[model samples]
Target: MSRLTELLSRIKAKDPKIGNELAKEIKVLSARRQFGLNFERHKPENVELANREVRRGDKIRVLPQRGSTKNSDKRLWQVKDTFKKKNDHLATIELLGHDVAETQVVKVEDLIVVAEFQDSIYPGLISTGKVEKGKDKPYNTVINGENYHALKALTFTHKGKIDAIYIDPPYNTGAKDWKYNNDYVESDDHYRHSKWLAFMERRLVFAKKLLNPSCSVLIVTIDEKEINRLGLLLEQSFPEAQIQMISSVINPKGTGRALFSRTDEYIYYVFIGSAKVPDKVGKGEEKEVRWRYLRRTDDESARGTKKGGPAQFYPIYVNKNTHKIEVIGEPLKPEDDISKIKNINGCVAVFPIREKDEHHMNWGLTKPSLEKALSKGFVRVSRKEDSQIQPYVFSYLTAPNIKKIDNGILYKKGQREDGSWIVVDPSGKSSRPTTNWNEKSHEAGAYGTSLLKALIGKRKFPFPKSLYAVEDALRIVVGENKEAKVLDFFSGSGTTAHAVMRLNRQDNGERQCISITNNEVSADEQKALIKKGFRAGDPEWEKWGICDYITKPRIEAAITGVTPQGKPIEGEYKFNDEFPISDGFNENAEFFTLSYHTPLAVNHNLAFKQIAPLLWMKAGSRGKRIQELPERGWEVADSYALLVDLDKSSEFIKPVKASKSITMVFIVTNDDRRFQAIVRQLPESVEPVRLYESYLKNFQFTIE
Candidate 1:
C-alpha cells in the first residue's frame, strides 16, 4: 500500500477524533508554507587545537573574564607602551655595542600587543543574615539575568543542592507583558511559540541539572493549552522522569456566564527520580480520643432483677472517700410465696437462690477491679435465707477519654447535651486523628481556614493558597528535618514566606524560604496616581513613571515590612540587590562605567566597572602648541598628518620645520556666527580642525 493509504487506514482504525484534528492541522500547515515551523539545536563552540592533536599547556579559553574600567583605559595604554618600549630598548642597547656608523635603528618585529584574557573576576558573596562563631548559614541569593543565563550560572555550582523548585514563568498570552532581550515581544509575532520555547528550553535544561536526584519541581499553569507540549518537552529533557498533575479548586462561585465557571488551576509535578511523601503527625494528637463510650442501661437492669422485690430496689452504696461506688455481697433470696415482684421504673425479673449455698458465691465485683475492691476492705459474701436470696447490683458511670473522641459524628450540631460538649470521658486517655476532615473542629486548628484569611489579607493575590494547605504539603516533603529549604519562584504576595514564618513560630522549626516575585505594581497604585492629579511625562512628576510606580514600590513593600499601601507590619525582611559576574576574570576588573557616547568596545568593558571616569579634552584649552605649517608645504591638504621621530636621524631629514602642537576648539552656541567667521578667516597654512561631535553638542553648537 502507498504511504498515504497506510496512514489513512491506521488513522481510521485507531482514533477518529485525533485523526480528524491531525488532518485539519496538516491542511492548515500546507496552506501556510511559510509558517516558519522548524527545529534547531544549539551547541557550544569547542576549543580547537593545532592538527587536532592535544599538547601540553594548550589551555582552552571557554569564557573570558570581565575587566574593571576604574583605571582600565589608563592601564591599557601603559601596558601597550611598556611591552613595545622594552623590546625597543633591548634592541637599541644591542645596536649601541656594534661598531656600525648607522645614525638610526629600528626593530622590524617589535609591536605592542594586548593580552587576550586581561580581566578581573567580581568577588561578591550574597548573605541572607549575620554569621557568627564559625557557623555558616545558607543565604537566599537572588540572581538577575536572562532566564537561560541565570540558570546556567546556578547550575554550574548548585547542582545537587536544591531539594524542591517551583516556577511560574511567562504564560505567553501575546500581551506586551513578556520581554525577550530587553524588549517586549507582542502576541502576534510570527515566531512567538519558538521564542518562548527556546527561552524555556535553555533554562529548563540547566534547571534540571541543578536539581538533586530526589528533588521535585512544581510548575503552576492553567488549562491544557501547553500541557501536552510541556509534557513532550519534559519527556525529551528528562526521559527517566515522571509527570503528574495536581488540580486545585480555586473558585467555587460562578460568574453566572454562558459557560462553566473557570474555578480550577493545575500544578505539574515533575520528579527527577523516585519521589516519596514525607511523614507527618498532625498537631493536637495528644488530646485526640481513640474510642467513645455508651450508657450500660441493659446491664443495670439485669443486675436489679436478682432482687426479691424489684431490680431497681437494690441499693447502690457510694464510697465518700474515693467517690467510687461500693459493691456489697449478694442480697437475700425471697421465698416463693413472698416473691410478689413489683415493676418499677428501674425494675426487672428476680432470681431465686438457696440460703445454704451462700459460701459458694458466683457474683464478682461490678464497678471496681477485683484487686482494688479487695484492698478497699471488700470480701465476697452471699446473703442466705431459708427459701431464696437476691443478689445486690451496683451502678456506675463508665466514661472514656474526652480527647480521644473521633471528629466524625461529634462535629455535627447537637451530638451531645448542652452541659456536655463531649460524650466520652476525659480520664487521662488521649485521642488519635480521624480520616474525616472538619474545618471547625479542635483537631483542625493547626490547618484551619483562619490561616488562609491571615495570609491573603486585603491584598487579593488571586487564588491565594491557604496557609494550612501549604503547611500540609511541606510536612509531607520535609519529614523530620525542620530546616528544609523551600523555594517558591512564583511567590504571589509572599504567602509562602508568611506560611513559613507562621510554621516556624508555632513548631519552633528553623525552616528557611526563598521566594521570587516580579515587581508588578498592584492596581491600587495606578488608581492612587490618577487620583493624585498626576499626568504622564510631566517633568515635575516624570520620575513617577509607570516603571517606577510598579517594580520599585512593590519590592520596597516586600523588603520594608510594609503593605502595598505603605502600612507598617511586623516581620520585615532586609533585601539587597545581588549582582552576579562571569567567573573568568580576576576581582579588580569586573566593573566598568556605561555610556552611549563611548565606543561600543569601551561600553562593553564599562558594564564590568560602573563608575570608571572618562577623560575628555575641551576644545581651545591651553596646552603645548605647534607652529603653523604652510598649506602649500602639506602633501595632503584636506587631511592633516604629523610624524614624530624621537631619534632625529640624519638619514631621514624633514622637508618642513617640525614642532610639537595640539589643537582644540569649543563651540559656545549652535548659532555662533562669530565662531564660524573666525574659522573661515583662519590662515590656509593652519591644519583643518578635527572637532569631537560630543564636545560640539555639549556646547550647543549649530551649523550657521
Candidate 2:
C-alpha cells in the first residue's frame, strides 16, 4: 500500500481520541521549536497565556523612588525568594531603581516583550506612498511579520473594535506551498493537515478576540482541498455565529483534472452577534429571477406591505377569453374593504397574487405599478405548469425568467374562452444576485491577475485574490458605517487592501485595513537561494519572502499609484469604467516589520520612544504629533496624548483636558503603582491606555 494510504489506515484503526493525542504531541514540539520556552526563570512566561513566549526586555523603565506608592509591581521585581528561582524574573542593571542589585528581582508581570519596528526597514510611511487622508479617517496599515503575534498585539489596541475579519489562509495542499515553523509541509507529509490546523487554531483564538463580537462578520475563502475542514473549524470556533456558505465561480472554464474540472471556490460567512448577511440588489431586470425571490412570495417587504405602499394596493384587470391583463384599476386605500374593491373594466380584478385563487389583499402594486411594469415589459399573463386554471399576472424585479418555474406564467398562452385575460412581453426581467454565483468580474484573469500585474509588474504571487470579490463581500457587511476597520490576517498579495482603497475612493468612505503577513523564507528554500549567492537574513533573502518582497511592495504600489518598478501606471479601470483609468490608487498606507527588543532586562525609557508608531496607528494615525515632548513627560494631540513622566504629568493633563478632542492618553511607566496613580490623576474626558506590557504578554514568540 502507498505510504499515505498506510498512514491513513493506521490512523483510522486507532481510536480518534488516541490519534488526537498524537497530534497534540507534534503540536507541543512544533510550538517549542517555533518559539523557545523561557527557561531563565522556570515560572513560565506564557504558561497562563495562549501562543506567547516572552515579551520585550527593553521597555523596562527604572522607577526612581520619590515616595512609597501603593502599586510597586512587586510581582515584577523583588528580593530573591529562597523558595523560588531567582533567575526566573530579574531586570537588567540599567533598570535597577535601587543601588543594591543583590535583592532586586524583576517582577514576572513587569518583564514585557515590546515590538520595536526596524527603523532601517520601515522608517515610517513612505513619502510618495501616502494615500490621500480625509478628516478623521484612519490610515491603512500593512504589517510584514508573523501574523500570530501581530494578531495578539492587536488584541491590546483593537480588541472588540473590528467590524470585519477576512482571511484566506494557506490551503495546506501537499505541494510544499506553505511553511510551519520555518519548514515547508510538503504534500508527502502525513501530518500536513494537523500542522496547518494547529497553526490556524491558535491564531484564530487571538483573531476572535480582535473582532467586535456583538456586530461583526467573519469571512473566509477556500477551495475544495480544505473547504469542508475549514467550514467545520469555523462552526466549532464560532458556535454563536450564524454560518453560511457561498459557491463563487472563479474559473468559468473549469480547471481540467483527473476527476473533473474545478470551476468554483467557496466563501464561508460566519455572522456573529447582531451581524447579518444583507440582500444584494442586482441590475434592475424584471424577467431573470435566478437568485432573487419572485412571485411576491413573502408577505413581508411586499408591495402593499401595511403602510409601505398604500397607493400601490390597486387591482389589474384580467380578460377571460384572451387571458390578457388589458387594463389596470386604481389602488384601494388601506381603509378600503378588499371584498368591496372591483375592476371598473368589467373584468376580474387581479391584485398581486397572494394566497391561492389570486389572494387580492397582497398585490404588490396599483394602477401606476401595472402601467410602469407593463412599460418596462415586466408584467406577464400565464397559468401554472400542467394546470388548466385561469391565467394570472406576473411582475418581476429584473428580467424575464431564464428557466421554468412550477408556478410560472405558462409558456403556451393557450386558446382561452371569450373574455379571457392575456398579456405578454419579452419574458425577461433580472433582479439581484443569489447564492449560486456566475459573474465575469470574479474571473481571476479578468481582474485579479491583470490588475495586480499592472500594479506590481509581474505575477509576484500566484492565483491572487480578485479585488472586486473581496470588496463585494466587505461592502455587504459595512451597511452604513463606511469607515469600518477591516482585518485581513492572510492578506496574500494585498488584494484586500486594494479593494478597501477602491471602495473608499468610490464612496469617499474612511475605512481602514490592517493586513498582517509573515515575511519568512522556509529553511528548505534558503539552501536553494544560497546557491544563487544569497544568505538568509540578507536583503536578497527577504526578496524571496512573500510579505516583504511581494505584499508590502504591492501595497506601496497600489496606494502610491505606481508600478513595482516605480513607474506610473496608466490602464483601464478593472471594475468601474466610469472611473478614470489611472495609475495606482491615491490612498496612503504604512508598512511595518515585526521585530522585538529582548534586552537582558527592561528599558522603560527606550520603550516609550519605540511605542510612538504603534500609538500613532491606534489613534488612526491622527496628527504627526499631539504634544511634542522636548525631553520627557508627554505630547498631546487632537486624538491622543503620550504621557511618560510624573513631573510633567500635569503639563500633559492640562492641554489634553482643554482640547476636548483627545479621547485617549498612552501612559508609559513600568511601575504598576505609578501607572495606577497616573490613571487616577487623568481627567475623565480622556481614557488612559497602557502599551507594550499587556500586549507583550500575548505575543512574545519570535519568528525564526
Candidate 3:
C-alpha cells in the first residue's frame, strides 16, 4: 500500500468522521499518484466565455491592459452595476466568492466573462452561415467554440451515435500553440505536461460518451511530444477499448533538430466494441479477393426519372436455377413501369429495389458497365433463404478490384468453372492493419498544406492535417457504412470535414460530418490586435480569429469548389478517389457559433429557434431542419415528426403513423405519464423522445 492508504487506515481508527472526509481526498490523490501514467488530474480548465453583455451577478475577468505583455490580475470578479461614464462604458465589480466590501470601476471592454469547470452553462447554437450545394443530403455542421463545452452540448444530440471521431488536438509543443485556463502554456511552465493531460483527459472523457458503444472508433493524431502520454491517457480513459498506435511519415524531409530529425507523427486508433480495421489492397500490403454488394445505399441511390435519372437504374435477368446473370436490360425510362418488366426465358428480372424498402435504390454499375464487368468474370449472384422484396443479392468487383488485377497488385489464384476468377491479396494476409503506415498521400506538406493553399489560396492556419491521411483513417473504420456519422471536435482548418466530403463524392455516400473549433487568433495577431484598441471579445478582434478567417472560409470554399475570391479551385484531388477540385461536391454545410443562454429563457421555451437545429441533428440530420416553431400543433418533415403542442396529440398521431420514413418523434410535454402514453400510441419504428426531459434534464445533470 502507498503512504496515503496507510495514513488513511491510521486516521480512520482515531476519528471516523474526520477520516471519512480525508479518505475522499486521499482517494483522489491516490488515483493520480498510483497510476503508471499520472498527472494533475483534477486541475480545472477555465474557458473565457465570449459574446455576452456584462450583467449584474455575472462573473468576469479583467483583460490584460493594452501594451502590457502579461495578465497581472487573475482574480475572478462579479458584476455589481454598469453605467456609461462620459464616452466610456464602465462596470462596478467585486471579487467573486469572497465577502469583500471593496468595489472597483473598470472599462467594460477591458473585462471578459469567464466560466470555470463545473459551472452550469446553458449552451445553444446560432447559425452564422450556410453553404448548400445539394438537397437530400445531411448538413455538415461546423461549431465555433471551446471544444469542451461544445462536446457537452453534443451529448444531448449525439451521445452514443457517433460512428467515428477524428481529432488532431494541439501537440503541446510549447510554442504557444495552445492555451489552458486563458493562459498560454509555454515551454517554461512547470506544469505544462500536467496541464495538457488535464485538458485532453476532460475532452476524451466526453468523447467516450459520444461514441457508439456497439461499434465505433476514436482516432487521435499527435507528434512525438505527447504521443506516449496520449496513449496512456487513452488506455486509462477507455480501458475496455482496443488501442493501437501507428507511426506515419508525414514529412519526408525531417524537421531539423539537435539530434535526430523528426520525420513522422503517431496516430492512435481506439476501437470500441465490435469496431475493426478495414481490409484494403495497397502497394507493399497484402491483397485479397474482394466482392462488395452491387446495390447502392447512399442518398444518390434513389431512383430517378428518365429525364434526370441514374443510368445504373436498369434491370438484370438472373436465371433462378443456375443463379447466373444472363442478360442486362436497357435503362428504364420515366414512363416504364417496373411492375410491367417481366422475366426473360426462365430468368428473373431484378431491379435495384432495396430491402426493408428504404428506397428504390439504383445499382452500383450501369447496364453496359455491368455487362462489361460480367463478361470479365467479376460478377456473382445469390439469394437468402427467405428474402422477399429483394429476392436476389448481387455482388461485383469494384474499381479497386479491377485496378489491382490490371496493375498486377493481386496474384490470380485460379479460375472457377463458371468463368469467374479467384484472386488472393498478398498484403498482410490478415484483416488487421500494420502498425507502420507510410504513404506518399499522407505527406502533410504536399497534400495538406499545398492542397489547402490551392483551394483557399493561402496558408491561413498552421499544421493542418493531410486531407488523404484523415480520409484513409476514417475509411478504415466507417468506410463501408456509407452513411456514417463522423465527428471531429478538434477540427483545425476544417480538414476532417473536407476529407469526409471527398469520401462521399468517391462512392456517392451520404456520410455526414460535424466539426468543432475555436476562433482563436495567433499570438502575433493577438499582439497586433492589442496594439490597436480592441479587447478579447471585441467584434473587430474576433473577426481575425482562426474560425472566422480560416476554418469557416476554408470549409465554404471546399464545399462550393471556389476560393474566397469566388474563383474556381484549380487543382485535382489525388489518390484512391481522384477528382478535379473544380468539380466541387454535392453537399451542404452550416456554420454555427456556440451561444450561451440564461436558464430562465430556455426553461420558458423562449429558445426554440436555437434548439430546433439540435433537434434536427438528433433525428439523424436528414431532410431540411425546421428553424421555427410550427403554428400548428404538429409538423412533419421528411425524416422526423415534431409535436409542439401536447393538446394536439390526437391530430398528430394519424399523420405520424401514416408516414413510413419518419424515424424520430419529439413530443413537447412535461407530464411523464402523458408522454409515455403518447409514445405507446406511436409506431414501434419511431423513436419517441420527450422534448423537455431529453433537453433540459440532460443539461441539469451536466457532467463537469
Candidate 4:
C-alpha cells in the first residue's frame, strides 16, 4: 500500500471522522511545506527527547524567541541537508525555512527538530562568582538564568540527584511583582493566574526530573493569593507523593492596618519515596528564655497605667550623673498625702507614660518591686533627646525582654516575676511548632528585616525570608541527610543559601544548596533605563535585577563571612535563649550564568573545550581535576572522564575499569556504529554517555 493509504488506514482504525479531517489538514500543509517523515520517529507527548537524527525535510523550532525582537522572530525552519563531513560528533544542516543554506552556523544545543529525540543540554556553565585561583570547587552552585531553560539543563546534569526543592514563587497577585516572557503579568490582565500556572507547570515538569524519585521533597510557598491553585497544581504534578501544607505566621499584627490581615503564608510540601519530615526538636526555642514584658499594665483596664491601680504605681529614682537607678520610692497609695512623704533624696524620679496620658501617668512599680528589679539589673531606661532628657521604659527593646502580654496570648511559662516578665517554667524543653506561630523569632520586623539590615547595612530587597525560618524548614524536612542537595530556584535575597551555610555550621553537615534566579531588572528600573536609551540585556538593566544586585552579593557575603558592605562579621549572633548562631559559616560556592555557545564547526561538531565544563558539572561538579594535566592523553578525574581523542580510548578504559572509581565515561565520536561497538567492549561498571549526539542532532533544519 502507498504511504498515504497506510497512514489513513491506521488513522481510520482509531477514528474515522478525525482521520478524514486530519487527511485534509495534511494535504493542505503538504502543499505549503515539506516535512521529512523518514527521519522522524513516533514519540509520545510525554517523551522529552526527540528522534536521534535530523533529516532533509524535518521541521525545526527556534527557542527563546522574544516576540518583539528582530532576531528569533523567524521560526519554523526546515532542514535542506543532513550529512557528516569532518566528523560524526556534529552534523551539518541547511535551512529551507529561512533564506540560508548553512550560513548561520548553529549550535546543536540551540534548535529542536520536530519529531526527534527531545533531549537538549545547555553549553558550559560560565563562572560568575569569584573563585580562588587553583581551588577545586566541589560545593554548591548558583545559576543566573531563565528558570525554565535552567531547569531543562539541570535535567541533563542533575537528573535523579536532588534531595530537596524549595521554591517561593511569585504569588501572582497581579502586583507586577513578576514578569512572564518579556511582559509584566499584572492583575488587570485576564488569565494572569492561568499564565502563572502554565509557566509553573513547564518548569515543574523538569524540576521533577532533577529530583531523586526514591527520596526527595518538593516544597512550594505561597500566600492566600495562589495557595488554592498551587495546591491543586502540586496534587496534579505529584499524584503519588504525600502532600501536606503548613500555615506559618509571617505578619501576625495586620490587626488594625487591614481587614482579615494576611498574617500567615502556606508551605506546601510533597514528600516522595522514603523522604521523611522530622520535627525540629533541638532548636534554641527549647532552651529556656526569660520572656519579659517591658511595660506594666493595670489589671482592671488591661492597659499600662490606664486607670485606677494605685499601690503598684510609683516612681523609681535614677541618678542623673550615672543614668542608673539609685533609689526605689514608695507609692502614693490613694491615701498617701504626697506632701508628707519625701521623694527619694539625691535622685530624679521617672514615671511610666500611659498611652492615653503618657506624659502624666505614674510609674508602674512598688518600692520593693523596684528595688528588686534594680538589684537584678532588669530596670532599663532610655532617653531619646540630647539636651533635656525624658526617660521611657525600655522593656522588650532587647532579646532579654518580651512583648507585654496584657492584650495578647501569654505563651507557655509566660508570667510576671518580682518586677520583670519571666517564663514560669525556667527549664527549657524542645516544643513542636504549632499552627499559630507568634514567637519573637518568627516576627519578620525584628528577625528578618532588622537582622538583615544590620548584617547588610541596607535593605535593598523587600520582604526577605527570615534566615531562621528557612533554616528551620530545612532542618525539619532534610532530617539527617548530611550532604543533601538542596535546590531553591526562587532564591530571593539568598536566604536559603544563608540558611544552608548556617545549618551546615550547626551540624557540621556538608549540605550543598543550589540557588537559581533570573537576573531580570525591575519593571520601573527597566523603564527608566529605556528612557535613557537603554534596553534589556544592557549593563544598567542587569544591575537592577534581583539576582545580581541582591541575591548574589548577599550569598557571597553570607558564605565569605562578610557583611554586604564587605566588612568582616564580628561578634556572636545569639538567640534569646542563648543559642549562639555562627556569625560566619565560611564556605565556598561556585556561581554560574546559563549561557549558549554557537557551533564553531559542524557535522555535530561540538568544541570539546567549550563543552568540558558542562560535562564536569553533570558529574556533580565533584571532579578533583579542574583542568587537563599537561602531556596527559585523556581528560579525567575520579568520578568522570571526557575522551576527546578516540586513539586514547584503550588506555583510558584500562585505568577506569581497574580503579572502579570512574563511573561515567564520555567518548567524543560521531560514529554511532563505532560508539556502540566500543560500548559493548566497555566494562559493565561504568556507564557510557555520548558526548555530542543530542547536541549535534538538535541544531539541524536542512531541506532536500
Question: Which has the greatest TM-score?
Answer: 3
lDDT of each: 0.34, 0.60, 0.82, 0.60
Order of the predicted models by lDDT, top scorer first: 3, 4, 2, 1
| Tens-digit per-residue lDDT, 1-704, candidate 3 | 58777887898999886697677656666567455687875547778876877777788888778767665477889899999989999999998656656679999988888877767777889899999875888889999999998998999899999999999998998897999877888999989998999899889989999999999999999988898899999988999999999999999899976689988999999999999887655556644465766766544445883433668778888777877778898888645688777658888788876543335667878788788888988876666445456677777878887898889777667766545677777765445578988889999999888888987886567877789999988889988989999999998899999999988987889999999999888999888887785766788989888888888988888887778887766655777654446557889999999888777777667987888878888888777677787899789988898888888999989999999889998888778998988999999999998877778777775333
User: What TM-score against the true fold does each predicted structure earn?
Assistant: 0.37, 0.60, 0.77, 0.61
lDDT of 2 by residue, 1-704 (tens): 37644664578577675465455544544455332221111111111111123433332323323232322232223222322355565443233345555334444433332222211111111111344433355678887666765675576568888999899888887766676644467877776666666666667787788889889988888888878777777766787889988899988898866698989889988898998866544333232222221234334534557644666666666665566666767667666776787545546665554332343334444456557656544555654332222235353433344223223652323323422223322344344346676678788876788777877777457788777888877877874678789999998788888778878876777788998876656556655765565533457777777776678777777665556675554443544422323334546676766544333122344433344566676666655543233465567766888876767876777787787678788876677887888788777877777654654553444321
Question: Model 1, 147-179: lDDT tens per residue?
Answer: 332232233234555566666566676655455
Better candidate by lDDT, 1 or 4: 4
Worst lDDT 10-window in candidate 4: 37-46
After superposition, the stretches of candidate 1 with alpha carbons farther than 4 Å from their true spots are 1-147, 175-177, 185-187, 214-220, 254-259, 278-473, 490-492, 517-704
The alpha-carbon lDDT assigned to residue 19 of candidate 3 equals 90
The better-scoring model by lDDT among 2 and 4 is: 4
**Model with the higher TM-score, candidate 1 or 2:** 2
Q: How many backbone clashes does candidate 3 have?
A: 8
Q: Model 2 compared with the native: what TM-score?
A: 0.60
Error of 3 at 230 (Å): 1.3
lDDT tens readout by residue for model 4, 547-645: 778787777666554666655533234443222121244466777776544444322444444455566667666646334422555666767876766
TM-score, candidate 4, is: 0.61
* Global local distance difference test of model 2: 0.60
Error of 1 at 489 (Å): 3.7
**Cα shift from native, residue 243, model 2 (Å):** 0.6
Q: After superposition, which runs of candidate 3 have C-alpha atoms over 4 Å from their true positions?
A: 1-25, 32-35, 64-72, 83-90, 97-99, 282-432, 702-704
The Cα error of candidate 1 at residue 341, in Å, is: 66
